[model samples]
Target: MSGSDSDRESAKNEAIRIIATDTASVLKFYGALEPSPGEEPLPPAEIVTPEWALFRWVQVQLLMSLDVFFRYRGRVPEASALTHCWYEKIEHDFLDAEYLVLGVLEGAFATFERKLQAYWQMLRPDGVLMS
Candidate 1:
């Protein structure tokens, strides 16, 4: 491959890495909010909210698309499209419920919530236009 093609491939791989890592971190943080079956018990009130559940569900979808993207690289247009769509959903949900979600999380999981927020901000398009 030419230098330009190699650079493009590298950027694609970097994007995949960032998405996969951030998704995993968010998933782990969400998992931490839940109580294990037996050893660790949590109060009913501390359980994940419906919004969190929805967020997690969408994150899982994004992860699945990321997996397909990794397997096929840029060859599978559908996988890339799905990944972008799912990511947009996540961003929209985060922006819309930022306060509600963070308020609940800040009480007990402040550090994790902050980290998740940072990740969310990092994913934003900012000045760049996304295709």
Candidate 2:
């Protein structure tokens, strides 16, 4: 293959690797919450640590961002426009979901609600997903 073709192939492989890595990270974050067979069931409040909450928040945000990007893929007017739109939607959805989850968990664990909200915001910085 020509040099340009070879370069394109390498870039494609790199992009695939990155996507696979992000997907694995998302799955791992969610998987940690599941109890293994014969494992004792911890209460929801006890299960979510601050660190885990932060990681979960990031993974959820990443997943939402990926969804938005994929939805707009091949149709966005410009790369920046795609990113701008994704961020707008993801940020709104993240806050909405966080509060919704907090509301559901509040009756049983009020403290968890505060911790989750804090951790979610603490980890809420700009993120980019591979196109």
Candidate 3:
């Protein structure tokens, strides 16, 4: 690959790493908001499961796209437009994600956390997820 291509790939990986770490920390913080059950009892290192990880992975993708949009907001109007389009896509997916993850957590009083839900929900009450 060319140097430009390599640079792009590097940037993409870095973005993925940053977003993944951020989202995982967010999940951990949410998990800390409440207790749990099972053979282990309480605190979990990973919050829920791989499902949460995957959701966060996608969520970070959306975030990265938005970041790119804002990064090029001035020099590249087209980038912003494209990023807006991706934002809408992620917003659509966020609904299914909420239903899937939060719905799963709903049954477990030990797992259910209002603060986490509120944190994410407040970002996009209209289901558009602006930021």
lDDT (CA) per prediction: 0.46, 0.46, 0.46
**For all candidates, what are the clash counts?**
0, 0, 0
Cα lDDT tens digits for candidate 2, 5-122: 5675575445434432454544455455656799976445434443354444544454345544444542545665657657786577677556534433332212344433432333
Clashing pairs in 3: none
Model 2 regions lying over 4 Å from their true place: 1-24, 27-51, 74-76, 79-91, 100-131
**What is the Å distance of residue 84 in model 1 from its true position?**
26
Residue 95, candidate 1: C-alpha displacement in angstroms: 28
Per-residue C-alpha lDDT of model 3 across residues 1-131, encoded as one tens digit per residue:
23575686677556544443455654654455543555454446464543454444445434445445545542445554767676775575455455534433332211144533443453323332222
Weakest 10 consecutive residues of candidate 2 by summed lDDT: 122-131
Alpha-carbon error at 72 in model 2, in Å? 0.7
Clashing pairs in 1: none
Q: Model 1: per-residue lDDT, tens digit, 1-131?
A: 23576786686556545543565555454555665567565334344443454443444344345544544554545554768777676575455345424433333222334434443344432322111
Q: Which segments of candidate 1 are over 4 A away from where they belong?
A: 1-51, 77-131
TM-score, one value per model: 0.25, 0.30, 0.27
Model 1's C-alpha root-mean-square deviation from the true structure amounts to: 15.2
